[model samples]
Target: MSTDNTSLHLEKVVPEAEDFLPILGTDFVELYVGNAKQAAYYYQHAWGFQPVAYAGLETGKKDSVSYVLQQGKIRVVLTSPLEKDGEINAHINKHGDGVKFVALWVDDARKSYEETTKRGAKSYVEPYELEDENGKAVISGIHTYGETIHLFVERGEYEGPFLPGYRVYDTKAKSPDTGLKFIDHMVGNVGWNEMNKWVEFYGKVMGFAQLVSFDDKDISTDYTALMSKVMSNGNGRIKFPINEPAEGKKKSQIEEYIDFYNGAGVQHIALATDNIIETVTQLRDRGVEFLYVPETYYDDLLDRVGEIDEDLEPLKELGVLVDRDDEGYLLQIFTKPVLDRPTMFFEIIQRKGAQSFGKGNFKALFEAIEREQDLRGTLN
Candidate 1:
């Protein structure tokens, strides 16, 4: 399904959902880059994504080419400049190829635009209609962190692979999916002292509520620390956690990302999976390098998270971390940076019954990040 012209085929995750923004889940994540063709290849080869849709000069788009790839319920749009000196090229120059658009699917783009802009969102793209033979799609957008945007997409009756002017990607090659279901949550890293401003932005402008919050005291290692607050929309279908660095003995992981990324931007996307071991196994075999904790982290795993369904040996072997709250347990692992900059990675998450965002694993996870930073010589 597309956040552009996508019709999500899955049932609502939240039943009897509270209807604030009335989101239909993530339609797609669009990234602006240097080479969309190569970016598409990397996602296909490394992450088991199949090419689903495409648009470019062949389709009368004179400025950019976009490749839409999908796996399970997840979709990603990779776009690059068809000509130099455009906004896409300038974006790549400033951010070094990261997420640009975190699109949301709505029933009425015009109303979505009016609702947020009236609530004080900086307007990016005015609500407009794009039409082709299949049907019409309405879309609008507003600015967010860095150069990122939230596109309100209304597909209405459109029923093609994606948006107008894009044809279904025809190919002989396809990679097996790694049990990834959908985007669980996307995390954003903000500049120093800037977390609450954006947090309030979502709460005030988009009607999102703060779900859970973590302070540096709750999420720090000896070397670094960060604070995060999870913000969820009315229906709980969309979640964004904003993070800012706290003073630490060394350059914390968030600071390193900010430094190398040159500004605040998306840090990671946590993808929900039906089977973490199987998904991670496939990703590992296919060349996904994950952050690893010491074998000793598993020594006290049972005592910490109580009993989990997964066998301990496999959990330890894969370097997957486990956490449990009153609700249930969750298995998750983090991939190393997916971009040249030390930004933009993926989190493979399998939530058994836990709605919590792996708070128990933060220490081990951040420590592992510091270890990686030490190797990169970026740690202060």
Candidate 2:
């Protein structure tokens, strides 16, 4: 874990403006699952992700099953265990369905781990080297809230398709690329009154500073309410939004997450794409189900946001939402809750140049989510 002093140093460096944030790009997202094979197939067929690598019993790995999938520059790894009672099983059982690892690219894994750990971060995995015919890869991990973790990856020293024993599958059956090129942000839900604790934890331990904050008033509906705060690393390569439930007439999304997941953990991963219409169309045709908004909502989009560069007809046809900022404009859409637990889902985002989250679409988006909540009988 990073120490308090390191947190102070980071606070001094990060600027309030978005332009000052330094983030290279996403590395890979790894999820702990109950069944890696089935999950991988669902992602490939439904979300347009292509199978890239695999590891398990066949590869002499006895404890776990891992499958790697890619679409454009985005890579996701799904991991499950061969047996029960292990850490993987424990994590799945406790968190229901959530991300286990957010791998970050770094020039040196050992140094990153040491620097962060010495500063006060909780050590999940010590820096270790793994080698095979493909060469060597160094990795280390640090614990975060619930079962989620951040892994430091130093792959410059290694030359491999993914890791040892995995051969790249060159298949022409690619899922049409959804304009998404990389991860934009990952949101997590925590328990009531725990928002500030996590904010401080991320700030103190991981060299992250609070970027934005929203209370119940900013993200509340007639039936539900929740508070949120966004945290970013020095290079903005990592963005985590922490949410907590607030008093409401009915169960807030954050409360529902706690109930289904059995605790706080990841809520959704927002992925950035270049063309949302094309990507969402491919995903829908491939079997991915997205959250639906009412057609009436689109009736006033043009007047609300003025004239956007893209034709509004295509976006409305695909159920996409648009939001603009002084910097630029962006198109976005969300998937229906993917897991049985209503724990983790995904966001498909296309940013023309804007860096802010889709604030303008919050009302329509929340209304869409409320529609789902009503269907699931989770709405109060």
TM-scores of the candidates are 0.95, 0.90
What is the lDDT for 114 in model 1?
Answer: 93
Number of the top lDDT candidate: 1
Write candidate 1's Cα lDDT for 1-380 as tens digits: 53344444444444432344668778889999889999898889889888999999988889899999998778899999988797888888888999999999898889989988998999999999888988888999999998889999898779888988899886787777677888999999999999999998988888788888999999998989999999887667799999999999999989988887889888999999888999899999999899987999998899999988889998888999999888899999999998878888999999998999988899999989988888889988
lDDT of 1: 0.88
| C-alpha RMSD values across all candidates | 2.4, 5.0
Error of 2 at 168 (Å): 3.8
Say what the RMSD of model 2 is.
5.0
- lDDT of candidate 2 vs native? 0.78
Residue by residue across 87-142, what tens digits does model 2's lDDT show? 88998888765688888766677887887788677999999988888788788888
Off by over 4 Å in 1: 1-19
